[model samples]
Target: MDLIPPPAADDAAARAEVADRADAYAAAPLLNCLLREVAEPLPRADGSGDRRVYRLPGGRPLRVRGQRRPAEPEVFTAGNWQRIGHTELVKLVVEELVRHTGLSNHELPAEMIDSRDAVAALLTARARATPPEDPYLRSEQSLLTGHPHHPAPKARGGGPVAGWLPYAPEAHARFPLALLGLREDAVVEEGDTSALDTLGEAPPGYRLLPAHPWQLDLAARDLAPAFADGRLVRLGTTDFPAWPTAAIRTLYAPGRDLFLKFSLDVRITNDIRRLWRHDLLKLRRTDSAALSAFAAIDGPAAWLSDTGYRTADFAFEELAVLVRDGLRDRVLPGATPLLAAGLVEGFDGSPLDHAPDPAAWWEAYLAQVVPPALAAFADHGVVLEAHLQNTLVAVDAGGTPVQALFRDAEGVKLLPEVSRAAGWERLVYCLVVNHLTEVAAVLADRHPGLDPWPAVRRALSRHDLPEVAALLTAPTLPGKTNLLLRWTGADGADARYLPLPNPLVET
Candidate 1:
C-alpha cells in the first residue's frame, strides 16, 4: 500500500499544509476513480488532535497513533482490522499503492488467505518484519466510486390546474403532486342550467374520483381521516438532493401537521412492508396496556396500506399519514414561531441537531425513548425503523425528550426474521451506526468533553429490556464496523484525519 508521510508535529504549520492537500485530494479525478473501484473511502488517521484514529463505514474504528521517533510512523492497535475481510483491504491497498507509487500491478503483494485468523496472523508478521521507521511500511486503503452527475427528473404537469408554486430549488429536484381534479376551463358541464353550474362541472378527461391502488382498501372502508378531515387535500412529492440514493419520496398531507411518505423504488417499498408487517404483528400479540401506553405517548400518527397494489412502478400507489399533534411547538416546526419566517432556521438545519443537550439527548433517548419502542416491538415481534428520518424527537415543556415519535411503518422490522441472521446487523448499522453517528458527531462538535457512548449504552440497555443493565456492560456484538473520518482542517496542507471506531463497542 502507498503510505503518505505523517505531517509535521507543529500544529500551525501542519494545519496550513493539510488544508492545501485536502482540497487537491478531494478534487483529484484519480481519487474518484479509485473510490469507484474499491466501493469505500480510503482509510487514514485524523491528524487534528492527539488521538489519530481510523474510521470506516458502519462504525468500525481503527486507532492509528503515529510515533515519529526513529524516522518512521507506526500504526498501533488497529482493532477490528480483521472484521473488514483482509482480501478486500488488500485489494484496496494494492490499488491505491499502485496509483501512488506508479508501480505495475505485477509488482504488488499477492493475497494468500480468506479466513480472518490467517489474515490476522499475516498482518502481525508483516508488522513485525517491516522496519518501524520505514515510510513505505504502512499500507492505507480507500474505495473509489464514480462521480455524482444525474439530477432527479422533474414532475410532469397534470391534475387540476392551479397556481404553480415552485418548490425550494436546492431542497430537491423531482416533485410529486397529488392529482385532485381537472379544472372546469378544460371541459363543459353536462346539461348545465347556469354559469355557476358550468364552472363546477368535471372535465371530460378528468376522472372525478381516481383511486390509488394502495388506497383502494382504505377508501372502500371509508377509513381515510385525511380525506374526511380535509387534511390530505393534495399529494406532494420531493427528492433528496443531498442524498445520492435514487429515491423519489411522495408526501400525502393529511393536515398541515401530518405527512405520508411514498417512494418509487421497490427495494425501499418492500423494506417498508417488511418493517410494518413485523410491527403490526407484534402489536397484535402485545399486552393491551403496553399498546395503550404506546398509543398514549406522542408518536408519529401513521398506518400502512398497499390497497391492492404490489409493484412500486405504478403512479401514486403506496401511502402513509403523519398523525395530528401530540408534540409541542419548539421541536415541531409547524407549531413554532419559525413556522412563518421563511428564513428561520429549524433545529440547526438538520433533524439530527434537534437535541438541546448532547449528553442528555442520548441519555433520555436510550432510557425513556428507545426502551418503550423496543418493548412495544418485542411484545408483538415487531422492530421499528427508529432511524433518524423515521424518528421524531418530541420534547416536553423544558425541551427535554419526553417521547420519540417513530414514523414510517414500512421500515419496521419483525423480530425472528429481522433480528436473526444479518438482519439485526443491518438494522443496527442503519439505526445506530449510520443514523445515530451523525447526531453524535453534531453533539460532540457542539459540546466538547461529553462522551456519546453512555447514551448509546442506555438505549441498548432498554432494547435488551429485563436484562438492561447487564446488556449495557456486556461486550457489544462483534464483526460490526463504522468508518467515519473527519478532516481536522483543510486537506493535503497539514490536516489530521481521525477515524472514529464504532462508539457502540467498548474499547
Candidate 2:
C-alpha cells in the first residue's frame, strides 16, 4: 500500500512563519467581515492616536493596527488589552455574530477554522516550494490572501490539507490532467470544443475530453456508475502538465495554448467553484456578446472568448469542461500579459513590484483597462465581470501597459436580459470598486503619499456612461457584505452589499 505524505509540519522556522502568515491570511477576511458587517468605530481608544478602534456587536472594544492589509487584533479584557490570534478572532466573530444577529451558524465557523488551517499548510508548502519560472504563472498563483473580503477564502470545503496542497497553485504545484473518453452516444457539447478533442486520443467510438485531476477525484464516487457501465473510459493523463491559475479550477496549458475550466466542488470564497449547467447553456451567447462588443471598441482591449464547452450527458454539470482562448492567441505582439489579481497580490519579478514610475505606470494601466469595460457596458450592452482575476494587462518590454484582455464568459451579463440599471450597478462594483480600487491601492502602497485616486477619477470622468457622472460624485459605493451573507447562510451568488465610503470621492 502507498500513502500520500502530509505537508511539511516540523520545521521551527517554517512553523513560526506559518503562524505569522496564517494570522495575516486568516484575519483579512474575518476583519473585513467584522468591519464591514458588525464593527463600529470607537475613536482614539488604542492610545497610538492613529490607530482605529471598533466595537464589536457583542460590545467588546477591539483595537487594530497594521498596513496595506488587515491589522493585528487586540481585544479589551482584564483591564489592560491583550492581543488575540486568528483562531480567537474567529471565535470572537462567531460570538459577536450570534449576539448581533441572533444566529449561530455551525457551518461558517467550521469553514473559518478550515480556512486558517489551510493557510498554515500553504505557508508550510510554499516555504519549501519553487515558484514558477514564467512570471505570469507566478503571478496567477500569487493569491495567498484571496478575496480579501470573504470570510473563508482558502477553505477547501473542510477537506484535509494533504488532499488539496498537492494541487495548490500557491505551492507552485503543477500536474498532468486526467483525460477521459465519453461514449459517443453520451457526449453532450456546444460550440468549438475542438481544442479539447486535441488534448488526447480516445478509442474509435469515444470523444476525448480533458479534466482537472483534482475535480475528477472529487467526483469519483458520483462517476463510478458511468465508469462501470462503460459510458466513460479512462484515457490516462496528459503527457505534460497544466499550471493552475489563481482561479483554482482553471488550468493553463502553455504548450497547447489552451485553458480548461472544470467543475470544482469545493467552496472557495463566494461560491462552490462548480461549472453550473445554467451558466454553461448561456455561455456561447454571453461570450459572443462580449466578443462583438470588444471588436467594436477602438482600443487594444481583447476578450479571451470562452470558445466552447464539453460534458457528459449523464452528469453535465459535474463533468463539465470549458474551453477558453489562451494568452498566446489573444495577447498583443511583443507584449507580456500579467494577471491583474497577481499585480495586486505581488509576486517575484512583478512589474508592479519594481515599477520605474508609479504614477505613469498607473495611468497607462488605467488607459488599457478602464475604457473598454465602460464602453462594453454603454455601447454594446455587454456588462463585463472585469474584476481583477478576469482581467489581464499585457505590457510592453519596459512594462508599460499596452493591452487589457478579459475572460470568463460565465460571469458576463448581457443587455436586456439584465436591465441597463442592474448591469451598470454590477459593472460599477466589479470594474470600479473591486478592480480599479484594488490596483490603485497597491500602486499607492508602493509609493507613499502618491494618491492614485485622481488618475482613477480622471479615467472614469472620460467615460460617457450616464452612471459615470453620478459615480464620480457618489458619496457611498456598494461594498459587498460577504461576511454577513455567509453568516446568514444566504446563497453565495446572491450578493448583498452595504454602502461603503467611496474612495473615488475626493475626500
Candidate 3:
C-alpha cells in the first residue's frame, strides 16, 4: 500500500490565510508572546489554507492552531492567565506542538515554548518578596541544625557533621569542600586544589583545563575539555538543594550537566524499580537467555551481568571503556560522529526541543540503536530505562542517531521484586512508550521512510518469545502510567481496569 504523505504545500494566499488564523488564535497576551518568540506562519500542507509554525531559536519546528473553544473572557482572566506563566504550561504548549509536528520529544528543549520577557519580568517582580539567596546562611550553627532535615545526607557525604552547613565557618573546620564534587585524590596547596582530570583526554583542536575538584566524577568525565589558556575555573557543585524536603540532586553541575533524576520524597525508595523489572522480564527472558541458549550472542551482554550494574555508576563507563579500548586497539576506531558533528558539549548544550531533524534522529534510534539495546538487555536479564531524558542520542555529521547513551540509575532496572510490578510498568510506559513515542511521531512526520512499528518489530525479533510476552502482557505498572492512561482512554478515562488481552502474540 502507498504510504500516507504529509500535508501538501499551500500557495502564498494560503500562507496569508494561515497567518490570519494564527493571529486570531494568538489574541491572548501569553500566546502572543509565544507567537513572537517561537511561532511562524507557514503554507498549509493540503493547499487548503494557511498554517502557523512555532520554533525555538536553533530548535525543532511546530505547528500552532487556535484551541477550539467558545470565546469567553474568563478564559483569559487574571488569575487563570497568571497560572499560565508557570513552566508546566509552557511545556504543555511545547508538547502539543511536538504532537502536531510529528517530532520526537528529544528534539524539543526543556524550555519548549516560553512566555514573553514582559510576563517573565512581572512574575519575577511578584516573587521578590523574599531574597534570592537563602537568608538562613547568616546563622552558622542554626544552619547546621537543619542538616538532619535533609533526606540524603549520607549520599551528600554527611556524617555526624551532616546537619552542619559547609559554608559556615564552624563547619569549614571539618568539611570545607563538602558542598562541592571535589576528588579525594586531589592534592591541595596554598588553599587551591589540583585541577580535575577529564576522561577520554581532551579531543583534538579543543583547549583543555583541569575540571574543578567538584566536577571530577562520571558525568563530568564524559565532557572534559582541554583549555590552552591554563586558567583555573570553578566547576561549581554537582548538587542542587531540593524543595520542601532537603534532598539533593546527586549529579547537578550548575552551568554544566544534570544526570538521571528521582523525586526527593522519602516515600519512594525504588526510584529505578521499573527499569529492573523490565530488564528481568523482557531482556533476560528474551534475547540474553535465547542467545546464550543458542551460543549465538555477540560481545558481552553487560546488562545481563553484575558488571553491567557496576558499569552504570560512571556515565555508561562500560560502553565508554569498550569504545576507548576499541580505539586503542584499532578495533572500532574513529572520532565519535556526535563529537565530529559538534553535538557533544557540556551541560549548556542540552535542550529537549533543539534538534534540526528530530524525525530523522528518531528513525535512526528506533531502527539502528534500539534493536541492539533490546538484544543486549534480553541476553543479560537487564532492564534499561530507555526514557527520553536518560537516553542521549549523538547524531552523525548528518544528524542521525549514530550513538545512543543511556544514563541515570532511575532508568536502569534489575529484576526479582526489586520494586513493585505496577511501579515498573508505569516507568516502562513513561520511558519507553510515552517518551520515545513522542519523538518517534516527530521522526515519522519529517521522514516518511522511518516507520516506528517496524523498528519495534526489529527490536522484538532480536529477543525471544517469553521476554516479549512479559512486556506485552504486563499490567499497567505505576509511576507515570496514570498520565498515559488519561491520554489513552475513551474520552480520557482509566481503561486498565477493563478487561483486555495482550496486544502482542507470542512467537
Candidate 4:
C-alpha cells in the first residue's frame, strides 16, 4: 500500500494550514488537563460570547473560546489579554504545573511540544492520503484528538516524524506484516496462537511468527545476533496488508479476520506500549474471567478475547505479539462495529454525529453499552476497562447502536484480585468518567437542549446493583487525573482520581 503520499511535496501554504490545525488540535486536550486538574474556573462576570474565564495556578486569569474542546486560549498578561499558541500554551502549562504541584517535569514539557509536532505531521500526511473505504477502518483510524483529557496524548515517543508516521492510524496507513521464522527452541508462546500460522509459511523445524514492521525496526539491533546465528530467519512480508487500528500497536487483517498487537517501545499517552511479561503471564486467567462474565449476560454485548501471544524467548517482551479475536462472529450480524472514541472525535460516517432522532439514538446507545459493563461488575466481579478506545458500538442498518463489543484483557482487573472499593473506583473512572462523559458532552453539543444524561441515568437505574442507587445520588464521580499523574511521574496503571460533580444525579 502507498503510505502517507510523501507529505504534500513542499507546499508552503499547505504546510501553514497543517501547522495551524495541528496547533488547535493539540491545544484542546492540554488545555482540558490544565483546566480540569490545575486551573480553577472563574465565574463569568459578563456572560458573553460562549467564552469562559479561568484562573491559572500562578493567579493569572486565562480565557478560552469554548467549553468542550476549549480553543483559542488567551492569558491576561502585561495588563492585556494575549493570545497563546500551542507553544506558549505548553510553556504556560509547565509554569503553572510547577507552581500548582511544586514539581518540575522537563520530559512532559518536551512531550507536549512533540505531541503538537506529531499532529502537524499527521495533518500533513492525512491531507495527501486517501481514507479507508471501510467505515469500520475509518472509525478505527479517526482519532486525531485522542483521550480528550490526556496531556500530550499524541506524543510519539519524541521520535522523528518519519519513524512513526508510516504506521500511524491517523495517517490511514496499511502495510503487510514482516514474517519471521522462529527456531523451535527460541519460540516462546502461550494459549491459542494458531491463527498466526495462517499468515505465512515457515521452513521445517521452524514456526511462523508474524512481526509488526514498526516493532521489527524498533528492535532490529537487539535481534541481530539471533538472526546471524540462525535462530530467526526472515521470510518477507505478507501478501495482504493489515490496517493499523486506533491502538497504534494493534493491526487488523480483514482478509485473515484477525487482530495482532505488538510491543512498540514508545510512550503513547501514559505507558510504553509494551506487552509486559507480568501481564502476558496472567492473560489467560483475566481473559477467561471476562469471557465468562459476558457469556453469562444475555445480550448483544461481546468480549473480543485476547486469545494468546507469541514471542522469541530471548526477546520475550520486546518481540511479544498478541493475537485478538476479530469482528466476524462477535458483532451482531448486519451491524457495523465502530470505535466508540471515533464517535466522540467525529468521524466521516459516525452514527452519533448524524442521528435523526437524537433522544432515541442516545437511549439505544445507553442500552447497548451500560448493561454489560454493570453486569460484569455486579454478577461476575469482572471490572472491564470499558474506556472509549476499548469499546466498539455496532450500529444497525438505521445507524442505531445495537451491540457493544469490548476488548483488551491486559487492562482488565478482576474483583478478588483487587478490593471491591478499588475496582468500583476504577470502573467509575473508566466507564462513567472517561467514556460516558465525553460521549454525552458531544451528543449534547451536536443536538442542543437534547439532554443525554437522563438516558444515562435511566440506563444505570435499570441495573439493580447496590452501587447504582448511590451512584445516582452521589455528589461527585471520580475523574482520572492524567495531567497530575504524568506530572508526578506515577505509573500509568496506578490511576489516581479527583472528584468531579456527578452528572447522573437529577438536579
Candidate 5:
C-alpha cells in the first residue's frame, strides 16, 4: 500500500526522510567495515541490547543506536553525545583511520561519499521503476545495498547518477549490446566463440564481436585510435535487449540462453570488473576442473562454466567478452534458478524471505550448497569462492532449494596453486563467514527462536573433510577487513581478515 508514497508535506518531514533513509542505507556497510576492521566495541554499561557503543582509534568514544548492522551514530564529544549524519560519519571514519593507520587516503573518503550518494540515487530510481516480471531477474536487480561487508559496495567510480543508472542492474536495466566488427587479423578468441559470430554478419575480413555498451563507453578514449584506423567498426546494436545480472558486468540474454561478461573499467567491490588477460588465458584449466568436479557430484549440484572469450587483439582486456554458460542446460528440470545473492538480498519471489517450514528450508539450502563446495575442496582440490553472488540455487515450485550451482573460475583456486591449508582458510571464509553467516542471520531474524547454526553444523559435519571437524570446533572464523584495507590503500584482491567468533562452536 505504501509503494511510492507521496513526499512529505513539509520541509522538516522531507529532510528527515532523506536523512533517515540515507543514513540507514549508507551507514550500515560503512559501519560494518569500520567496526569489523578498526573500531573496538566497548561493553554496554547498562547491558542494553538496543544501544551499543564502540571506541574509535585514539579512544574517540563512538556510540551507535542499533545492531545487526549498526546505525544512528553518535560520538561522545567534549561532554555529551552528538548525532552525526552520513557525511560526518564518513569524516569520522577518515580521521580515525588516518590516525589508526598513520596514513592518509584521498580516494576512499570520496568513494565513501559516492557510495552513499549512489544509494540515494538507487533508492529514488527504484521507487519509480517497475520490477521485472521474472522473479530471477527481479532478484538479480534487488541488491540495492550489495556486498554487505564492503566499504563502498554501491559506489560507481564516483560518477554521477546520469552516467551509471542506464546500465545499473539495481534499476532493472536491460539494454542492447553494442555490436562491433574487428578486422579478422586483429581478433583473438579461444574455445567456443562460434555463438558470437552468428550474432550478425561481419564484413569479409572482419569478425563479429558484441560488447557491453557501457564498457565501450568507458574505454572510449583508449579505443578511439582503433575506430579511427578502421580496426574496429560499429555494426549497430543487438535487436534484443540483454538483462544485466547482479554482477553488473555480466548480462544474461534469455533469447539465446547465453551469458556474456564484459570488461567494464570501473571497480565493483574488491577489483575492477575488467576481464583481465591473465585470468582469461587460464579460464580453461579452472573451468575444466570445476566441470569435472560437478560431474562427479552425487546429486543436482551444477557449475556454470566460463567456456571461452573473444576480444580485439589490440584491446584485449577492454574489448573482451567472456562467454559464460547459461542455466537452462544444467538447471534441474521444473526448477527455477535464482541467484543466491539475490535470495539473500530479497526480491519479489525469494524462497527464503518467508518459508512455511524454516528449518526444513534451511536444511535443504545447506544440503544443496555446502557439500558441493566442501567436496570440491576435499576431492578435486578446487577451492570455490562460494560467496553469495558467485552461487545460484534452483528451487522447486514449493520454494524448496533443490540444486546449487557455483561459477566464477576467475576466483577459483586450484590445487598446487594454493596449499590445502590456505585453500581451506579461503573456503571457510567464503562459505561460512561470507555466505552462510548472512543467510543464517536472515533465517534467525525472520524465524524467531530458531537458531540456524545447529542445522548448518549438522549439514557441514556430514562432510568427510578433515577441515570440517576443525571448522565445527574452531573458536573463530576469518572476517575480511574491507574498510582498513581500502583505508591503507591495500590491493583489493589482497584479502586480510581478523578472527570472528564462530557460531558453529557450542559453548
Candidate 6:
C-alpha cells in the first residue's frame, strides 16, 4: 500500500475543488435573483439561528447560509432538508419561476448551467495562465463572477469551451487581431477612423480591418461569399497581442493606446453581445453627446468616447468594430484607472482592499464618481450608464480615488429620447444601485461597523437637482429585473425594474 497519494489522486481532488468553487460562484447570483424576484422571506418562527429561510413561489421552504453571496442552499421537502448543487438549484429555480410567472422558459436554465460550466472553465484556465503585469489590465480581467446579481453573468452562449476561451477576459486571454483587407467600396465608416489604417498596411484599393478572431469564427458562414469574392481578403494578424477588458467584446491594445470593440454574437448577461445596425447608425450622435457632456464638466471626470466605427457594408453588424478613445489621452496624470466593477469584485492591487482610511476613501470615491454622473444628467441631458462595468475610478499613488471616467456610448440615453422621469430612474439604478451600493457593501463588509451610507447621503445632498431630494427621501430605488427579463424573453434594452428598499432613506 502506498502511503503517499498518487498524482492522479491529487489531480482529482484539485478538479473537484475547482468544480465546487465554480458551483458556489455560479449559485450566488441565481440565488440572489430568486430571492429578489420570487422568494418571500419567512418569519423566524423556528429560531433558525444563522440560517435565513424563504418561501419559494411553489410554497416550499428554502434556506440559505449567507446574504450578499448566498450559499449552501437546501430545500425543505418531505419534512427534511436536502442540500442542492448548481444543477438542482437551477431546476428548483425553473420550477419556482414557472409557478410564479405562469410561464415556462427553456433558454434560461441552459444559460444558468452554461454559466456554471463557463466558471469552471475560467477557473481552470486562470490557474494555468499568466495574469497581465499592468494593474489596470489586471483590474479589467478580475471579474471571474461578474454582474453579481445576474443569473448567468458568465454564460458563453453554451458554446464549446475552446470556442470562447481564447478571448475570455476572465481567463486573462491576450491574442493578436485577425487582420483583414476590405475593398475600398465595401468600407462603411464615420468619424476619425484614420487609426484603422495605422493598424496594418493594406493594398492601394483596400483598407485595413482588424477583427476579433472569435467574431470571425462566429460570422464565417455569413462572410464566406465576401471572402470568396474580391471584397474581403485575409491579411494575417496584428504583430502584437490585444488585451481583452472586462467587457469581453472590447479589446485594449496597449502599445497603440487604442480600444477596439467588436461584435460578439454570444449572449452575455441579458443580450446577444452584437453591434446592431441600429446602434451603429446612431453611434456618432450618441458618442458626440457624451463627449460634449464630459467636456462641459468641471472636474477631471472624462468620457472615453466611441469616436467612430468601420465595417463592411455586405456584413455590417457581423463585422462592425467601434473605435473608442483609449486611456492614455483621457486619464488623469499620476493616477491609475481601475475598473469600478473590478474594485467591487476585487483584485490583487484593488484600492478598496488597501485603503488606509476607509471613510475618507469612500468620500473621495463618491466625490469623483457621483458628481459627474448627476451633472451630466442635469447640465447636458446625457444620462450616463454609470454602472460598475461602464465606470472607471482612477486612484492616486496612495490608492485614493481622484477621478472617474465613464464609457460605452451604446448604453447612454439622451434626455428627450427618454422622458426625464425614466432617464432619472435609469440613472439612479445605474449609479446608486448598481455602482455605489455594491462598492459600499464590500467596503462595509471589509471594515466592520463602518457605515458607508452617511457619506452617500452627504454626497447626494451636495447635488442640488430636484430629483436628488426625492431620491434621498424616497422609500425605494429601482432595481433592474435581470433574471425575470431573461426568463420572459424580454428585449435586453427594455429595462423593467422593481422597487428595492432605499438605503439612503433608511440610513
Total backbone collisions for each predicted model: 56, 0, 41, 0, 0, 0
Give the lDDT of residue 123 in candidate 1.
Answer: 26
lDDT of 2 at 150: 81
* Model 5 TM-score relative to the real fold: 0.96
Score candidate 2 by TM-score against the native. 0.97
The per-model lDDT (C-alpha) reads 0.32, 0.86, 0.30, 0.91, 0.86, 0.91
* TM-score list, all predictions: 0.43, 0.97, 0.36, 0.98, 0.96, 0.97
Q: Candidate 3 regions off by >4 Å? A: 1-363, 419-427, 447-451, 467-507
* Residue 494 lDDT, candidate 6, scale 0-100: 94
Please write out the lDDT profile of model 4 over residues 54-173, one tens digit for every residue.
998889999999888999999887977789999999989989999998999989999999999998888878877899998999999999998789989999998887788889999999
Report how far off residue 494 is in candidate 6 (Å): 0.6
Tens digit per residue, CA lDDT, model 3, 206-307: 222222122233234443431122222234422332111112222122122211111121111112112232232232233333234223434311221111
Q: Kindly list the per-residue Cα lDDT of model 2 for residues 318-385, writing each as its tens digit.
A: 89999999888689899988999899888888888667899999999999999999899889999999
Question: Where is model 4 more than 4 Å wrong at Cα?
Answer: 1-10, 46-48
Error of 1 at 162 (Å): 21
In model 5, which runs have C-alpha deviations exceeding 4 angstroms?
1-19, 47-49
In angstroms, how far off is 310's CA in candidate 3?
16
- Report each candidate's C-alpha RMSD, comma-separated, in the order given: 18.2, 1.9, 18.7, 1.3, 2.8, 3.5
Q: Comparing candidate 1 with candidate 5, which one achieves the higher TM-score?
A: 5
Shift of residue 468 alpha carbon in model 2, Å: 0.5
The CA lDDT at 139 in model 5 is 79
TM-score (C-alpha, index-matched) for candidate 6: 0.97
- All candidates in order of TM-score, best leading: 4, 6, 2, 5, 1, 3
